[model samples]
Target: MKLKFLGKRISGILAILPERELHFDDEIGNFNFSSSNSLKLKKIMGYGRHRLADDDTCISDLCIFGLKYLFDAHLLDKAEIDALVVVTQTPDYLIPPTSNIIQGKLGLKHDLLCLDINQGCAGYLVGLIEAFLLLGNEAFNKIVLLNADVLSRKVSKQDRNSYPLIGDAASITIIERDSVERGIFANLQTDGSRGEALSIPAGGMRMPASDSTAVLELDGDNLRSKNHLKMDGGAVFNFMQTEVPPMIEDLLNYAKAGKDDVDYFLFHQPNKFMLQKLTNKIGVSPEKLPSNIVENFGNASSVTIPLNITFNLGQKLKDQSYAVCLAGFGSGLTWSSMFLRMGELDFCKIVEFVNKGD
Candidate 1:
């Protein structure tokens, strides 16, 4: 779908990661590969290290921590928050939405709308669209768009193809109405036929977790149990190579924006190899497109977009105006992108969980 945003701005973006860092050398024994194979992966997948949450941590915990940091820093006000939208595949519970849990913890207004969207890579784009649309209501002036997931727990330890590539993270983006009008343009799409290319086979209504779900199988390079995350790496690569470039082209054309017109192109940090391929295929210069987020933070799903904002252009975004093209692909067989320019954000930084539960 093509989208347009009016009277809206991404005022700030904050990302938090669990402080526990895992180095490749320490995790070499966990994978099913030889040292040489692992080294190759490190070089190709940008897998020197990635962070993981404590066994006791949750996505809401990370997101709440980030919100508190922003509030403490006076970057945002909890009382003024009109809505909370948390996009995650690993919510705290299937019953009450994680957004509600966060709303209560943060002590925001009772009337604040809370929604949970179970999405992955394409999540941030969709979350931003939701925030912009909510601004259509005259009553709602600010919305917290939280995109996060503890994906490490969903991947099996023995899965060499995926376990090493997954990382845990949460990002909080504050969107609000600004007098200076800058419309956010977007294009979101889904191809369900290719959904199975990346999925968790169990723990859902169709296939509840059971003894069968715990059974591990050697499915291609993915040696994961039915309960673990699965992926047809080749299929995902092919889709990125063929479909993603055109999607970007369509988004730019629909928005009447050019690749050169964009100051930065931030994309989901799937891996170094695929990013390189996409950069070449899409004809985006390496200087304007950055793909090292996975090398430092891992493929943090939707959080990667904000992570990129803070990681590569955090200070710049906080100090000046620049056109940005944000894209998220992989998982959901979905891909989406948006174009916008932001300046002088209230907050743009990454935090480590210093006090785990806090």
Candidate 2:
């Protein structure tokens, strides 16, 4: 369960994105209809700063800012990174993938291996595992994994049930083979059958764009047309309650650690209610759960877990034997959990001495 760390390192992590303050009133409750009918209703409650056009700093830009900040903080030489991976379901463009866009903006070498993953929520963990494997070969040294998803663009603002809950954001974490921690212990899961429960019905190869399709309407905060995110909320919740706890337990067992041994539980920030439900079912104390950013950012899709970790680094995580469990469940109805042992920065010694009035 222990990994050798001659030099394996987590160079840095950064979350760079604006806070989305979405609001809604109880009047939305009046539209209680069947799932199909509900899908057509304008459900999104509200949005913060909606006037900023799509071209103004997209999720990709936020991701790049995070990566750049991490690289600068770690003082990494530009020539050292050998590979880059970007994970997202909402890429900036459909043609060249966000990874290529990031590579070009960052000025990374064209020869450096670059790729994109079309995973939904589990994308970050899957991308991290891939980065670790590439580093483990010793052929590649430093690797950057960037995750960003702008779900707001796809969410039908007209749908009161879903519009108020989706947000946009991005995060980046750099992984190296020989630094601070082992990063991830493998125990990832997927359920393709349930994929239909959480997905966008159109805009893919199966349902390509067509002139016959009606022009999607944006009604206030809700989407008033055909193109919109569809979800069977009850089914998704059932899946999470039944499947996630056992998967996490198994992952901890494989790591040779108990639930109590874990210092922090960082689940995908779907919402405060969902997080609380999962924590109670898993029997983990409320204090052990990481504070979610969903209140301010809603659900940032794949970027949630990493952003939560980065934002809370210095506050709740000082010199602790931290066990980080990341669980991402969304779209593809896909879910994954990875365990890692994290050591906090050594700042206590300085704080202790300085506080003595010396």
Q: Which stretches of candidate 2 lie over 4 Å from their true place?
A: 1-9, 25-56, 71-74, 179-183, 211-224, 315-321, 344-358
Model number with the top TM-score? 1
What are the lDDT scores of the predictions, listed in order?
A: 0.87, 0.65
TM-score of 2: 0.80
lDDT of 2: 0.65
Q: lDDT by residue for model 2 over 145-222, one digit each (tens)?
A: 878777777766556646656667666667776544454565677778889887777778888656544466544434
Candidate 1 lDDT: 0.87
State TM-scores per candidate. Answer: 0.97, 0.80
lDDT of 1 by residue, 47-138 (tens): 87888888888998998888888889888888899999999999998888999999988788897899999889989998999899999999
